[model samples]
Target: MPRTDTASRVITAPLDRVWDALVDPAALAVWLPPAGMTGRFERFDARPGGSYRLVLTYADASGAPGKATADSDIVEARFVDIVPGVRVVQAVDFVSDDPANAGTMTMTWQVTAVAAGTRVDIVATDVPDGITAEDHAEGLASSLANLAAHTER
Candidate 1:
């Protein structure tokens, strides 16, 4: 069965800034941490049919080095729906070298402005069977926290 993971965080930043950080390669590289991880965007169209690819490198918690890279060579992402600074729905897929995980996944990122800050919600489906949901959740939350710090600075 496919697993789903969701995580959310409130960033002390404006929606526009958050949105920029989400799409900008340089900005994304600043955040999204597994510690010592960097992201390289091959192609980011941001619109429907646009493609995106990112590389992440970091050390495992046990002090071992590892990488979690993904390439959406032909993204089917689209602005299926939008609410200005409120929310956005896009289709996301990941292509990995691992044979166990070679398929498309749909991911949606929702942003909502609150009195304290902007609440960013991320939902990912079709996670590989071997990977645990909790691990994905923690990774996403960690990334979000890193993003919050990056934007706050």
Candidate 2:
């Protein structure tokens, strides 16, 4: 069965700023990768029906092997929906030879104005079985923290 994982954070920034950080490719390259990893986008088209290819490389090569390469995880994602300042939805897949990791995951990012700042929520559904629950949770938390740090500045 597929799994779902979620993470959320409140950023000390306005809704627009937070939303910008989410859609801008440069900002995403800076904040999307989890701890111990760094990401770069080969192609990015931020619009509904558009797509992107991102490569995330592990800082320590000796760590667990990546899904696509020895040190990198390549992700192909399509923009399913984009609601400026409100939400962004994506269909994502990893480039991997392992059958357990072959699946499309839906990622939804929602932002709302709150008392102190903007609240960002991330929901990832249909997660592949190859990604363990604990690891996914940690990665999601790490990415959320990164986004908060990047946007709150």
Candidate 3:
């Protein structure tokens, strides 16, 4: 069975700024991690049928210095729906090198504009067997915080 996890956060920034930070590679690298972590996008295409790949490096939760990795090279991302500055729905699939979990998964990012800022919701389904929902939740929260900071600045 495929497990699903959802995470959300509200940022005090304009919708356009939030959207730009989400799609731009350079801007994404700046706000995609916690204080001690950093990320870089290898390939990113904002439109549908495009591919997206990013590398995230961070110290373990125990404060130990180590590299954490996540890759999605075979992603067939498509913009399912868009409402200009209001909202966006995207479908993402993961490609893994491990033979044990070679299947693809789908993730949806839903953004809503609010009076104070923007509300972002991410629902990822079909997570591989070894990955835990709690860990993914923590990571998504950290990334959203970083994103909020980046957009505010």
Task: Identify the leading candidate in terms of TM-score.
Answer: 2
Instruction: For model 1, name the residue pairs that clash.
Output: none
Candidate with more favorable, higher TM-score: 1 or 2: 2
Worst 10 residues of 1 by lDDT: 67-76
lDDT of 1 by residue, 1-153 (tens): 777788898899887888777766688667854444555565555554555565555433244323233311222234444455556565544444555455555667778778877889988788665446776777788889888987765
User: Candidate 3, 50: how far from true, in Å?
Assistant: 1.1
> What is the TM-score ranking, best to worst?
2, 1, 3
TM-score of each: 0.76, 0.98, 0.75
What is the lDDT, from 0 to 100, of the residue 140 in candidate 1?
A: 86
- What CA RMSD would you report for each candidate? 4.1, 0.7, 4.0
Q: Give all candidates' CA lDDT scores.
A: 0.63, 0.94, 0.66
Off by over 4 Å in 1: 60-84, 88-90
Residue 22 of model 1 has an lDDT of 73
**Candidate 2 wrong stretches, greater than 4 Å:** none
- Separate clash counts for every candidate: 0, 0, 0
lDDT of 2 by residue, 1-153 (tens): 999999888888999988998899999999999999999999999999999999999998686789999999999999999999899999999999998889999999999999999998989999999999999999999998999888887
